[model samples]
Target: MGINLQKGQRISLKKEAPKLEQLMCGLGWDVAKKKGGFLSGLFTTDFDLDASVLCLNQDGKIKSNSEIVFFGNLRHYSDAINHMGDNLTGAGDGDDEQILVKLPLIPQNIHKLVFVVNIYNALERSQDFSQVENAFVRLVNLSNNQEIARYTLSGNGYQGKTGMIMAEIARVGDDWEMMAKGEGFQVKSLGDVMKLYS
Candidate 1:
């Protein structure tokens, strides 16, 4: 078992799972289905939410665009990190999107991995996290399939924000630490996020 992390809480991955090497960061959410009369079905539809990862160095910065892993680019150049794939509708019960990282294989220069979620073309669609219910990001120890830490995201605070900064895994020497961010931003695409991290 692992800790259920609250907003702003952080945990040492190494302390919880000393033998941890490979990690799986899973993100899940539900597309709100508005209830109405017979016409309700017309308005209820799946909204596309994208999960992305920004790889940063020891100083929390990316050296190149190749450090970003997203639907368009699923894997990092070094093959240390990978995005399992994109989940557009958030229809699954478990993880909608997954990013796997070979912690031990990560180069010494890379020190931080930032996980983010954004609505696909939210600016044009006028959609935000407000319509996303039961959003969550969790880190698991792939070796034993035990969750290391989980952060549940609420939509209340994301009123006008189209994107969210889910969590971060920081490299501390040979160990790793997880932090719950849950911060919302105005960006609409992964490219916008790279501008901030790169």
Candidate 2:
């Protein structure tokens, strides 16, 4: 069936929706100085960082140690899908990982796609000390390379913590939409992030 989408319309999906064919997820952050810096860039600087999209999966179930693709810059990007090792760090400008998941075809069972931020290292600190910002995910139609839906994590709830987020992307009528939800935890490792699914 053909998918229908309206221009500039925001869509949200439920958790139990089918998986999408081509998924395009991006991670971004805002790097601003928290305090004053030196004229020569030698002073202490703070960044208002936030990870927008953390968790995203197609209709198929994401297994352990999957290769997820991380594209875009600290702010945004157009080309390149950087491959990252599972449980690794994509820190710094233009640092990201693209995860490739292999799953069995489950027909309509793979209806929803979930996006999350793996906060496995920022639980003990306070929100102000936490540096996760501007994270988000988007569904792309592989057939046309068109972005169908997207979601973002904002506000104080996303200030600081080490955990994963849950965003559902499902088919609405013919097109798709994104539903974002925050799930906090004292994540110590990637195993913890995987535990959410288990």
The TM-score leader among the candidates is 1
TM-score, model 1 to reference: 0.94
Q: Which RMSD does model 2 reach against the true structure?
A: 8.8
Query: How do the residues 1-198 of candidate 2 rate in per-residue lDDT, one tens digit apiece?
Result: 222323233354222134544444544343334445456357434332233322223524444333222222222121122223332343465324333222222223244445555542344333232455545444454445555554444555544456545455444554556555555555654556555554
What would you estimate as the lDDT of candidate 2?
0.41
The C-alpha lDDT values of all candidates are 0.87, 0.41
Superposed model 2: Cα runs more than 4 Å off: 1-20, 30-32, 37-95, 99-113, 123-130, 170-177
> Can you tell me which runs of candidate 1 are displaced by over 4 Å?
none
- What is the C-alpha lDDT profile of model 1 across 111-164, one tens digit per residue? 898999999989888788887889999988999999988899864878778889
lDDT of candidate 1 vs native?
A: 0.87
Give residue 160's error in model 2 in angstroms. Answer: 4.0
